[model samples]
Target: MSVSPEAIRSALLARREIALIDVRQEALFALGHPLFAAQIPLQRIALEAPWRIPRQNTPIVVYDDGEGLAEPALHQLRALGYTQADVLEGGLAGWKAAGYELFEDVNSYSKAFGELVEHRRHTPSLPAPDVLALIEEKADIAILDARRFDEYATMSIPGGRSVPGAELVLRAPVAAPDPDTTIIVNCAGRTRSIIGTQSLINAGLPNRIFALRNGTIGWTLAGQALETGRQESVEKGEGSGHDLARERARDVAYRAGVRRIDSADLKGLIADSDRTLYRFDVRQPADFAAGHPAGFRNAPGGQLVQETDHFAPVRGARIVLVDDLGSRADMTASWLAQLGWEVLVLADAFDGPLETGDDGAPPPRGPHGRYKRPYEGTDNREAAMQAYLDWEYGLVAQLERDGTHGFFVI
Candidate 1:
């Protein structure tokens, strides 16, 4: 069976459940593909198909650049019980022939959506030099690293503490109790920093909040030193701080039209075999391994939002986030809601007995097909870093032309 590019485009615009997969290596997929395409290389089809595309009846459309992989991929998907698998009519060439846009990078649309949020909301930011000056002066400032703790520990700004994106709203108050202290959020690159800073702003944090413009890339470009093996993190405990964060995040999530569901409602959603449901525990990996609600996989809220397509490949699928702390799930759901997802926060479901150990599945592909991200690792070339920032800068314009993204910044 063959599917037309126009048909896929229409389905995307209408927010229908469709999985447009690019059966190519990550490097090639990163070079160019459709705005909503998810890369599940042909070799890893068997490994990824079951979980990534959970619904056997999901409308699956595979494409390749005349690489002879699409048809085989469709067969593999079918063998895996994907009953509705089909190929793009003309592959990548066909998509181009139809005069549609081909986006670059794996998580292209999600990055573009982040740029859209910044463009729409004018998210506040501070350049690296200015932030460095404050640190040198020993000013009242709290630098929260919004990337994962492992990433933060690798290299970070001096005196910066790990508070990952999902933890920002929940723990920022505890990290910087003084409202007079300026809070600066930084990630490895732009997207998480923008989203993290905006999250705090949306939650109505009293402190002056700003994204470290261009994140660690800007800090390096400015000739600033980065700390290695730093162990600082937000103090963990429940108190008035947690209560305030919960209230604030709940307000933001409600404003973004995120639904709050009890266990019964979650069960009903799960029972609806017609729809695809993803249950996630939006907490840190260690915390998730320590204890999380049964049947929910661990997905740190920040990474989940930053890589929504990678995490939830099936577009239009419903997502239910579980978090005992309330703030992480609520804040994460708010962004997903704006990104046009039917997202909900699973409330009070974690009060019962919890399971331990990591239940999440790793990405199917190994090192062979993986594209080396310019923003990660310690040895990125200056040119590559600059090129990455350049790509991000153009996302807003690209998103405008794409026109299918139903993202709304709050």
Candidate 2:
């Protein structure tokens, strides 16, 4: 069976639980695809289909750019028990012919949504040069890197401490104890930086907060130096500070309409076999490895928010985040809720000793089809970096035209 691009577009606009899968290699898929399409390369279908498209009866439409891979993928999916598998009538060419937009790069929708948030909220930020000058002047400023710790260690602004996204609220108070201390949050690029800065703003932090504009990319572009092998991090706080952070995060989540789920509610949700459920532990990987509730996958809160599409491919699915630290889960859930997810944070759910080891989806396929994001590595060309920033700036207009993203800022 085959599906038309118009049909797929209508389903997406209607917010139906249909999966538009790109059956090409990561490299090609990264080049262009329908905004919501998830890349599950033909070769990895058998390995990934069951886990990614959890419902055997999920309406799945596979496509490729006339690469002759879609039909094979459709067959493989059906053989693997996907009852509603079909191919795109005209493939990628057909979708484009139908005048639907094709988004470039992986996690396109999430990145686009982040851009939309920044555009709509006019999230405050400071240029890298100004930030550098502040550092040189030894201004009363605290730079918190919102990317993963390892990413921060790679190349970060000097004097910047690692405080991954969801950890910002939990750790920022300790990192900048003085309410007067200026807090600057940054990521490799704009998305996490925007989200991180806005998170603090949403949490009602007294400190003056801003995102390092364009993140490390702008810093590098401005001929500024970045520190490598940095070890500074915001350690977990104690007593009233931690409790205050937790309460603040929960309040933010509540405001965003995120639900609090107990073990009983979680069990009932799990029992609903018809719905796709994603249970993630939003703590750091090291913490997750040390101990996490069973049946939950480790997706650090920062990465989970940044890569929501990769983690939870199925739109309209329910997500329950597990975290021993209430602040992390609450903060993560708040962002997820704003991003149009039916998200819940488990409260005091884990009782016994927790399980260890990585339990998430298989490791991501290598960089074959992955776009070498300018914000990621140190060696990207200046043109590519600038071009990436330009693309992000235009995402709000694209989202408006797409008219299918259920995202809302705040």
Pick the TM-score winner: 1
Could you give candidate 1's per-residue lDDT for residues 1-410 as a string of tens digits? 79999999899998999999999999999999889999898988998888788889999999999989998999999999989999999999999999888888778877898899899999999999999999989999999999999999999989999998999998898888899999999998899999999999999999999999999998887788788899999875578878988999999999999999998898899899888898899999889999988989888999999989888999989999988889999999999999999999989877789999988585546678799888777788889899899999998888788788888887
Candidate 1 runs further than 4 Å off: none
Estimate the TM-score of every prediction. Answer: 0.98, 0.96
Q: Please report, in order, the local distance difference test score of every candidate based on alpha carbons.
A: 0.91, 0.87
RMSD of each: 1.2, 1.5
- Lowest lDDT block of 10, candidate 1: 360-369
The local distance difference test score of model 1 is 0.91
What overall lDDT, based on C-alpha atoms, would model 2 receive against the true structure? 0.87
**Candidate 2 on 65-131: residue-level lDDT in tens?**
9889998898898889888889998999999998888888778887897888788788899999999
